[model samples]
Target: MFRPGRLQTAPNVWKRALSNFESRITRHETSSDDKKDLILTILSSTATKREARNYLSKYPLLKENDIYQSHRRILDSDVVSQTSKHDKLINDLLLKHSARSEIQLPEPPQKPEIQLSDTLRVALIRIPTPRRLDPETLRGIALTLRKLVQLGVSPVLVLDGKHQIAAGESRLLTVNDFVHQCDTLIQALQTENLQARTVRGLFEQENFSLPELLVVPLLHGIIPIIFPTTVKKDSTEVVMTPFETLKCLVSNLCGFNEAYRRNNANDLLTVEKIIYLEDLGGIPSLERFQSSHVYINLLQEYDDIISELYIGHLDSSVRDVHVQNLTEMNQLLAIQPAATGLITTPAIATLRHGTRTTNPIIYNILTDRPTISSSLPVNLKKTPQLNTTVIRRGTPLTIHLSDDQPDGKGIDLLEFDRQKVIDLNKLTHLINDSFGKTLDLEHYLNRVNGNIAAIIIAGDYEGGAIVTWESAGGRRVPYLDKFAVLRKLQGIPGIADIVFKSLLLTYSDELLWRSRKNNPVNKWYFDRSTSDYCIPNTCWRLFFSGSRVRTLDDLKGYVDVCSKIEPSFV
Candidate 1:
């Protein structure tokens, strides 16, 4: 069907066109349209399909071709099935026309690489309603569908309305029908494709396998669907998330959800007291809510001085109000349980409720609020007093993890646990001495129960630290949850140093913790730390030891998680 003589005369035509095109360019005497048409004509007359393909590849402007027509003519000739030579020429022409053009085009996409395994990869197609579908959107969706088909992905489409056509042996079903049987869509597709070869053979026998003459109507307000020719298999790896980690996250989210749901009050208080003499103020707004009733009862206990302090005196000047209220409030907060309980009640409650959930939304809600211990007491007794001096020189002090309850030869070292039942009052007293006030005991317990190895207590509980495993960038490492020493025992030579050394030696791995940026103890922490960084606009300074932080991306994940935690110590 390919005439060799007709092709052989192409060189003469190309030479004439080349000379004319060059003359037009040199003289600037021809329009761009005329020059392009002339070059296209010369290229079409090439001596062979190879020459035409090579010529088009080199110039890359003359792109149109009648390769499909040529292919059809060859297959319909007396030499049909023996027309490999003609077929090759038509394929080459088609490839050249499709591959080379004035406009640059990317390479044709290939199907996703998949192993020839027995496992199946599920594909889902979300069907959209036709009432509001646009022509341009339909075209884009069709193109994506074609790509999916080319990749051997036969997605099970969910139809929403009645359909009239039969796509070979494929069946259409209503939304309700599909929804009821939706779980079986993958099995159906796999079964259908598995028998594709047999169905194709039947069609060939019935004389319907050949290309047929049919008019393709313009596609509009319709979804394009593609069926698979054969069953497809793809390889995938599965991973399981830790239950403890998920539980922790959900608890945090639930606490915040409850906080917002229970209280609609703003964070600022109705009344604030500032004292220049003491350089102190009443507890934070959340604390005020927690202790409102307690503070009112305390005012009645000290009723003798109420009139002098203008307690409930509405007509007093703003200056008088500040002078009187500030002094009384400061004195009330100085009392042991009252000040400590006010600050720690909500934190402990929130932590307790937080243990019941691990949702990401709850985690996000919790992080939006300030952590419990971001601020410190303006006044703390510097001269420490010990209730008992039990340790002697060279006393073998061992650090052991507490297993749910305190157990060891020196369990008495943790004085707060002497009551046997670890309750809120004991924890409050413990924190009031160690930190300036009490902390959220429930939140601390949850962290301990979920991820922590144990509570590391020193001899007779002179000092201790909460230790846990935390994941960052998928790598789990040791994290220090809380560290505290009895106020009186602090600054004693070898008291804290031995506990620190023993714990570090025991884990022998990377440890991470955050300290308040301006805390006096940070100087000691920084001296022993391998690395430390102060976060902007926050009071926290993250510290790490035993390993080098790797990439900035890795550091970012660690920072984001740690920064979101409320101050764990008061």
Candidate 2:
């Protein structure tokens, strides 16, 4: 691991220096000494530059002018064929600066336009371990990988697991550790998204870079490779080493004949047929840095990798249970793919199939259908028909008022269509079961004004809302005081979706609600909410859908005051 003792200068300062030098270089016919001085000044390390100049002076062919010209030659080369030479020259400069403990790393290649290759199936590349990567450097790496993947290259990143394990040896390897690492990678990839979003959250703004102008050379016909690592041998058993496994995978991916390789031990593989894998520590020397674009492609890839594996957003215990289930299922099926020796989901298979979109599998999951599709690698014993009707149609919502008779002569709660009045006691019974607690019947009736209600069907409330006005920011905001459905109807396809959509359509403009932090349904609430707040020392997270809570102060005040209300469930 190369420990860079001191980090490079700020990006702005580097850009300013480059800008100044470019203007100077174009206008002036400076002397050789003047040009050398400018190079040293731009490098920002006089001592290191002097030593490098002395070293280059040893060769008669390497003039001061030639050294200056080399930098221009590198920046001008527009093809991947010429990158290797430029890479070596830059590495030589970096190594010299490393020795001196002062190096200003070059700015990322400017806006490298990606073009998908017709032939390459996968391009295996390495990235720096998390600690060494700043957001800019990480963005550069992600953009490069995305370009490769866009060009029909399946980028299988080889992270430095050995180093990570060694660094945290005292701490045991757990799912949390893996999750943290994945989150870091995902955050790095989301640099693009972080910049593009309109609202700049406190942390998001500092960690990600905004887009900048750049022009990078087009990458073509470059198949960079590094030797694979070796594993220990067992005396009694024959096992494939890591390198052997890698070679076999390469052979398979490139369609190399195993028989031909077996007959000749020293058979040289063609470049087109071989897969390239690089060490994370060495990738810097091989490629130029990158700048992030506003596109969300890298974030999508990160989501796909984690979600397809079913590891994202899961706690350790849940992940373990899932893995155990998979293990048992795999044993029962007796089917394992050569790639990972595990049963693959349609979502994962879609990624490996080189398809950019996992919409088919996603559509299946969203519609509450099976997580796999007919396109999965393993053939199922029975395959269901593609569901045409994921959503169950429902009658539009209606709000109805109770019979306005004095002295409590009319019903307190009535159906939306006003065809019949709902028995408050029956409504309480159903709500108690749905909420897993006795409904505060008196408080609920009072909040509903003992008259008006929003209901799905008029005869009896299938799903409904009982709301009251709350004065927030000097406005009568409709607070969703209590919402419930019959326990039997819960999770029935489109029951909640249609009911909520209809309710929102009725009161399209401003509403507020607070859900218990522990509620599983909070995810649904959060998704619909335009703005939200999590009050400290409280169980409820208040959410607002409309444009009422415009200021942070108002939002905070509303959430803090509303969350203090006594537990509504009971």
- Strongest candidate by TM-score: 2
Tell me the TM-score of model 1.
Answer: 0.28
Summarize candidate 2's per-residue lDDT along 1-570 as a digit string, tens digits. 544442354666779878866754543333344345334422332123333443233211223133334556434543223234234534544464365345333343333222323222333323334554555556655544433332233343333344454465433342234345545765655553211111111011111110100001112222222212222232121222222323333434334323335755532222111111112110010001211110111111223322433534445654444343333322222221211111222122222212233222222222222222211111122323221111111223445423334443323453322544445556666668668798666675565554342333322556666655566667555667667767766653333554454456455666678887888778667656676777788777887765343776667657755865576455
Candidate 2 weakest ten by summed lDDT: 208-217
lDDT of 1 by residue, 196-284 (tens): 10110101211212111000000000111212111112211111111111122123323333443465442101101111111112221
Candidate 1 lDDT trough over 10 residues, lowest sum: 212-221
Cα error of candidate 1 at position 269, Å: 59
Off by over 4 Å in 2: 1-362, 365-391, 401-419, 423-426, 450-460, 568-570
Off by over 4 Å in 1: 1-392, 395-398, 401-428, 568-570
| Alpha carbon lDDT of each predicted model | 0.36, 0.38
